[model samples]
Target chain A: MNSLIRFIQRVSTTLLFLVLLFLSLWLYISTSYYQKAQFGRLALGLSGRLAERVSGIGQYIRMREANIGLRQENVALKNELEFLRSYITLSDDKTMRYSRLTLFDTLNYSYIMARVVNNTVNHQQNYITLNVGRCDGVEQGMGVVGHDGVVGVVLAASARYSVAISLLNTDFKVSARHRPTSTFGSLWWPGRSYTHVRLAEIPLHVALAVGDTVVTSGHSAIFPRDVPIGSIVGYEIAEGNAYSIDVRLFADFRSLDYVYVVRSADRSERLELEHNFSPNAND
Target chain B: MIKQLLRYLGLAVLLFALQLLVFNNINFHGYVAPYIYPMLLLVLPLSLKHWHLLIIGFACGLLMDVFMHTLGLHATAMLIVAYLRPFVTPSDTSRAYAPGMRMGFRWFLKYALLGILVHHTVLFILEAFTFNNLSITLLRIVLSTIASTLFILILEAMRVNGSER
Candidate 1:
C-alpha cells in the first residue's frame, strides 16, 4: 500500500498534466458550439468604447470623407422610403385581393452599428475584432455588412468584444446567387486575392456574365436574400465538374470601419428547416 | 535576487500586453505574427524542478489565453513544451553555465524552437478544428510554424544583445 502511494506521488505531476490537458480539450470542444464566457458581451463594450475614443482621433483626419459618405447613405435611405410609400399606395387596388401579408411577414433584417477595434485582413482564416458584444445585442453567426456589401459573420463574442470570420478568409463559405436568375452557388475565397472570391458548385448552364450581380440567397441566418455580395467577374468549367465563377467583392476590407451587424429575426425557425433539409451540414 | 525576480515578472507582463495589444493586431501576408512570450518559458532556470517549470509554463500560457479569449489553446501548448524541457536540456551543447548563470542564448534558441513549434502546431490545429480541406490545413500549419520560428529566433538574438549591454 505504501509503495503504491509512493509510485502515485512520483507520477503526480504527469497525472496532473494529463488532467489539465483533458480539461482544456473539453473546454475547447464545448466552446466551438457555445462560447459562454461573456466574450461577445465584453467585446462589444470594449470595442464601443475604443471606437468612441479612436473616432475622436480620426475625426480631424477623415472629416470631409465621413460627411460625404453619410450624406450619400442618407439620400439612399430616403429614396428607399419614398419608393416603399409609393408601392404601398399603388398596391391599394380594390380589384386586386389583399394577400394579407405585411412587411413583418418577410425576412426582417435589423442592423446594429459596430466599430472595428481589431481587424486582420491578410490571413488565411482572418478574423476581425469588433467593439460590440452580447450586451450590445451581438451574437454568434450574425452577418456584418459595410457600405458596399457582406463583410463577414460573427464567430465569437465577449462582454465588450466580438470576433468576425471575414468573408475574405479562405475558410469562409456562403450560399450566394446571381441577382436576376436567383440561381445559387457557394461563395469562397481562393486564397490568391482578397478582392476576388470563387463561386463554385454553380451548374455549367447558369447564364452568367462579367457584369452580372451576385447576392446572398437568403439561405443562411447571417444574411438576408439579395444582399449584394459581388459581381461575376469570370468563370471556367472545371476538369469534370460544375462551373467555377470568379466574383469581385464590393467591400474593400482594408478601408472598412463602421459596419452593421445584421440580426435575423427568424433565424431559429430558418435554422430548423435548414437542419431538416441538410442533416449532415449541421455537424 | 528579489529585483531580478521582479524584472522577470515585469517582462512577462510586458510581453503579454504586447501580444494582446500589438502583435495580435499585426497581420503580415496572412500568417506571420510573432509570438515572443514563449521566450519567458525558454529562459526559465534550468535548475528548477520539472514540476515548477510545468506550473510556470502553464501560468504563462493561461495569461495569453485570457486575453486572446482562447480558453486552453495556449495552456496546452505551453505544458507540452515545459514537460519536454528536461530531456532536451542536458543534451544541448552550448556554453557550460557556472552554477548561477542562465542557459546560453544558442541553447535557449534550440530549446525554445521546439516549444514554439509544438505551440504553433497545437494552435493551428485547434483553430482549424475540423477536417475540411487537407491542403489548406497543411499550408496554414507550415506557414505559421515558419513565422513563429523566425519570431523566436529574432527575440533570442535581441535578448542576448540586451544582456550584453
Candidate 2:
C-alpha cells in the first residue's frame, strides 16, 4: 500500500496532464457540430464583449471604405428597384401588378443589422463573432450576409452576441447554383486562399464558363434563394464525371464591418416538417 | 516571490491582448498568423513545478481558444509544448529561459524555433483534422512557424535590451 501511494504521487503530474488533454480533445471534437456547451456559451459572451470594445478602433479606421461600399450597393439596389417598377407599370393587367407587389411583400426573410466584432479567415475552421445575438433576434442556423453577398450561418447565439461559421470554414457547405445553367452543387472552402472557395458535384456535362456567377439555391431554409455567393474562376475535371470549379468570392471577409442576420419566418416550420419526413434529413 | 508572480501575470495579460487584438488580424496571404503567446511558456521560471507549468500552459491556451472560438485546439497544442519545454530549456535550473547576455544566441534561437514548430504542427494538424490536404496543411505549419519564430525572437531581443538598462 505504501509503495502504491508513492508511485501515484510521483506520477501525479502526468496523470493530471492526461486528464486535461482528454478533456480538451473531447471539447474540440464534440463542439465541431455546434458549440452548445455551457462553458462555451459563457466564454463566447465574454470574448464577444472584449472583441467588440477592441474592434471599435479598427471599425473607425475603416469607416470610409465601408461607407463607399454601402453607397455602391445602394446604387445597385436603386437600379434593381427601378427595373421592377417599370416592369410592373408596363404590365397591362392591373390585377397582375397587384399580385406581384403582394408576392414581394410576403417574402419570408427579414434582415437584422449586426456589427462584426471578430473575424478570422486564415484558420482552417474560421468563425466570425457579431455584436447582435438572441436579444436582437439572431439565432442559430440563421444565414448571415454582408452588403455584397453571403457570409455564413450563425452557429450559436448568446443573449448579447453570436458566432458564425464563416464561408471560409472547411466545415461549412452551402447548396449553390451555377447561374448560367441553373445546375446546383455544394460550395465549400478548400482551406486555401480566403478570396476563393470550391464548388463540387457539378457534373461535367453542365456547360460552365469562366466568370459565370454562383448563387444560393435556397434548398434549405437557412438562406433565401438567389443570394450571390461568388463567380466561377477556373475548373478542372475531378474523379468520376464531376468538375471541380474554383470560385472567387464577392464578399471581402478580411475587411467585413457590417452584416445582416437573415431571419426566416417559416424556417422552423419547414425544418420541422422536413425532420418529420426523415429523421436524418436535416443532417 | 509575490512581486515576480505579479510581473509574470502582467506579462501574460499583455501577450494575450497583443495576440487577440493585433496578431490575430494579421493574416499574411491567408496562410500565416503568428502566435506570440507561446513565449510565455518558453520564458517562464525554470523552477516552476511540472504540474504548475502544465496548468499554466493549459490556462493560457484555453484563454486564447475562448476568444478565437477554437475551443480546444490552442489548449492542446500549448499543453504539448509545456510538457516538452523542460527538454529544450537550458540544463541549468537557476535562470529563466530568455535571449539575454547569459544565454548564447544560437542556443536561444534553437530553443524558440523548436518550441514554436511543435506548437504550430500540433495546432494546424488538429485544426485540419484530416490528412487529405497534406500539402496545404504543411504549408500552413511551415509558414506559421517561421512567422511565429521571427516574432518571438524580436520580442525577446526587446525584452533583453530593456532589462540591460
Chain A TM-score for model 2, please?
0.92
**Global lDDT for candidate 2?**
0.87
List ranges where model 2 is wrong by over 4 Å. A1-10, A36-39, A281-283, B95-102, B161-165
Q: After superposition, how far is residue A143 of candidate 2 from its true place, in Å?
A: 0.8
lDDT tens digits, residue span A1-283, model 2: 9999878865997898899899888878887646632345667777789899999988879999899989998999899999999999999899999999888887769999999998888888888889998999988899999988899999888999998889998888999999889999999998989999999999999999999999999899999999998999999999989999999999999999999999998889988898989967757
Model 1 agreement with the true structure over A66-91: per-residue lDDT tens digits: 56666877898899989866766687
Q: What TM-score does chain B get in every candidate?
A: 0.82, 0.93
TM-score, candidate 2, chain B alone: 0.93
